[model samples]
Target chain A: MSVENFLILGLGWAGIFLPTALGAIGSIVGCARAGQAACGALLDVESGYGRLVGASALPSSQTIYGIVVTMQLNRQVSVEASPGLFALGVLVGLALLCSAVLQGSCVASAINASKSKPEVFGLAIAPAAIVEGFAVFAFIFGLIISGGIPGTLAG
Target chain B: MPTATNYYMLVASLPRMPRTFEVEQVPISRLRLQQRLEMLNEEDTTTVQQMQEFLLWDRQHPDRTDTEVLQEYEQLMQRVRNVLARKIIVYRMDVRTITCGLRRRRLGMDPPSGVGQWVQAIRENWEHPDFRLARQHPWIPLVRGYMEAHQPLQTERQLLLAIWNQWTRLADRYYFSFETILLYLARWEIVDRWTRLNESLGRQHFESLLTEALGEHARFPQ
Candidate 1:
């Protein structure tokens, strides 16, 4: 496959997965804070669960997006395609997929934390942002690599 | 059969009890009228004539302590209280039902407006005729008490205490209505109103009364 094909696939994956990963990370932090505060008199355990679930659930949209892009790219590539471009596309897809996984996992962790101390929700945003930043970095890198390849070597 | 003569004698004897004369002492005459009205079961021509004469006398004599007049006023006030209580119950129930319906649809979403609408509705409806009439009945008794106290110059504490006592009486009735509504309605707005009203009257009024009383005492130094 051409460098253009690899870049398109990477962009699509990033577009779908990055948001999901960021949202998941944010949810995780929020849930953790909730858990920490759960011991107090004001803590509402049921509401905490609802909030945690809401936060964690946001990342699933990105996972579905990443999967669709991966399948599309796989169909576009053939055995005769340039190995270099194919390898690049595969690496970009992996990065995007990893980000989604990280987001989902973080969200899950936050949910667990919220169950114990519901008051920690305010502090969860930072870690989620950090994870999001990494996802963005990978996305930009994939886009740049794809853009640099010549058109004739694209497919 | 408590006659009109009995009511006249009761009113005439009021000046004897200096303490009871100041405040409303249950108006036994009016209570008798209410009881008589409730007990009138026969459609006898003589009883109907007596009833008509009683109502006519009540209307013609503005200053008369006729049992029928007092009973009429009592009935009017009772109707007002009932309507206000009913409106409060309906308003609270509607809010609770609507909130529950919304919750079922959204899974656990908090209502965006919170209790703001409920508060506004309550305050607005508070001026309804029924609520107004119910609120007015106690004012007469309060004024009567204050007048009978016959203090040439009232102390600030005395005035504050009197006002606070009246307010507390009114608040008690208001709370009764509120609690009745709350028994069936779980919306935050009703709860918010109860809390806000209690705090406003109880704490805020208490502080203001104390400050005013202290200020007066400082100036007079008695």
Candidate 2:
């Protein structure tokens, strides 16, 4: 393929895969870290099986958010829409990924703190909530931009 | 009420069972008064000291479970607050006391106030022999700051009941306190202003007590 065609094809694949892949990456790493913290926490607490489990899963939401955004961006990878896809895909994907990982760390810390001192569990989750805000922004922005893309099916 | 076995023991020991029964009932009230008086003598002692005494109590009363101790404690607490007559307070207080004992703190996500000061104070005195501080928790500073800022001017036992009522009214059922919050509260025997506050404002405005006490630093609603 010619260089131009090759670049277009690359952009097309990057548009769909990058957001999904990066989001999953973020969720995986984030959940894993939080889960590790949760496991450590379980040893000390008399009982909080549900809360600890729920906290570790908090970072996993970014992955679903990423998937929804990616599905929205998936469409005819024509040259006309390629640039939009690239920008939305890469930026939103990275944001979701970063937010997820950061949220995971926050949740892990929250779980650990709550395990020892459960009263602070609500407050400890505040940082994670703040981090979730960025992911919501990314999701909304992706949704808006996807609407503007020509010839793409509704996501 | 003495059991049949206890009655036999009284008869075997005293020979005059009816007189012994009258003397026992009178002395039981006196014994309680004496115990309360003794407790008042060291009311200013630290949590570590209290914890030690509790442990000794446990050891001495090998046949009594923690539930029995808690029941006895709750009876004393009820008398102190004059709530034995209030049926509503009694029912709610029972649940709160049970929940507090089981959970060791209120259940919620809102961070307690004054966590920063609490963490700082704990770190400074981390070498104390009674309590163990978990240094690795990431939210330690935040938790400490929240508790220090929000902790009520009451005894540890009262604080448990306060949060029980406060958090329940907030309708955020799944609240909890950091272990350090309990540790810090246990360390002191602060005079309770809640009783006065409740008298003036009624029990419903317990949130206002937190607000009034916290002044500016109280961020959480309950």
Candidate 3:
């Protein structure tokens, strides 16, 4: 392949992987922090394993959303599809990244609060769920728009 | 450590027993001392004699009010607060433990939101009208006596009423759930009275109370 073809192919690959990679990174970091909070909470309280584990995993859904978007955007890589792919991939990934990390922080706080006052567990998770809603919107729109990208007929 | 001035300010804040009242000839006990202090609030003449007797019974310091007695009483009240707080913590733990066990058995996974739904149910229903009435009645003495007696897990009606009132108020203002409120009452053996009935029968009793308290058509619905 010519150098020009190689560059376009690389860009295409970047578009495919960027959002999933960034989202996974966000999920890992966010869940890790929440998991740490869960551990601390367990040391002080005798029960509530479900809330701790659930809160810690809340950010992981972003990664799945990213994967779905990535799959929806999957198609033959060519210069024609690069811009649309890049725009959707980078923007959706960024949204997932920010939302996951922030949701993780919210979950961590909820876990800590619930540890001391288990009665607040349900109310405390409301913020994280709200954050997850934003991620879902991005994922759905990304899916809707990715289908419209035009592929080149050139061989 | 507090400076001497600060210590003096703190001590000055609490009401001092009057010097004019003569100490009574009767024996002084902690319970009698508490009763005498309460009697002071009633404007009752009988309480004055008990307070004077309890205040000056000290042999080494007959004339001086053993401010130490008052200080000790304050400490006792603080201890009661501590015990109540611990009981709340343990009750929350119980909810989490139960939710966790159920989740593990049912889903083979950790609980997602702990006992959040259960907590929410308690928080929402705790303020039923019956609970409010319970709070109006003072039951601290009953609670303290039960704790002192080290009785079994049986509940007392007055104590239960008092706790339902206590926790319902907390639920109204704070994010705490019904368990925290109930456990605080239970720690003092208050809920045991309500629970003494069969579980379904107890449910019916509370359901009726909640319906009446909330004035709602279907609050705490079965």
lDDT of each: 0.38, 0.53, 0.56
Question: Would you list the rank order by lDDT, best first?
Answer: 3, 2, 1
lDDT tens digits, residues A1-155, model 1? Answer: 67876665555444334433443444444333333222221222445445654565544443444344333333233323334345545565455555555664454444434444567755653565566566567556655554444333212
Top lDDT model: 3
RMSD of each: 26.6, 24.0, 24.0
- Tell me the tens digit of each residue's lDDT in model 3 across A12-111: 7788777898899999978876776666455446676776877789999999999888887777788888878888899999999999988877887687
Interface RMSD of every predicted model, in angstroms: 31.1, 25.7, 17.2
lDDT for B163 (candidate 1): 32
Quality class of the docking in candidate 1, CAPRI style: incorrect
TM-score of chain A of 3: 0.92
Q: Which regions of candidate 1 fall more than 4 Å away from where they truly are? A: A1-44, A48-50, A61-81, A152-155, B1-222
lDDT of 3 by residue, B57-128 (tens): 322353533255345434433443334344443343333333333324334453333332243443343333
C-alpha lDDT (0 to 100) for residue B23 of candidate 2: 24
Worst window of 10 by summed lDDT in candidate 3 chain A: A36-45
Q: Give the per-residue lDDT digits (tens) of candidate 2, residues B25-105.
A: 222232332332232222223322333343234226657645675575555444442221232233333333332222333
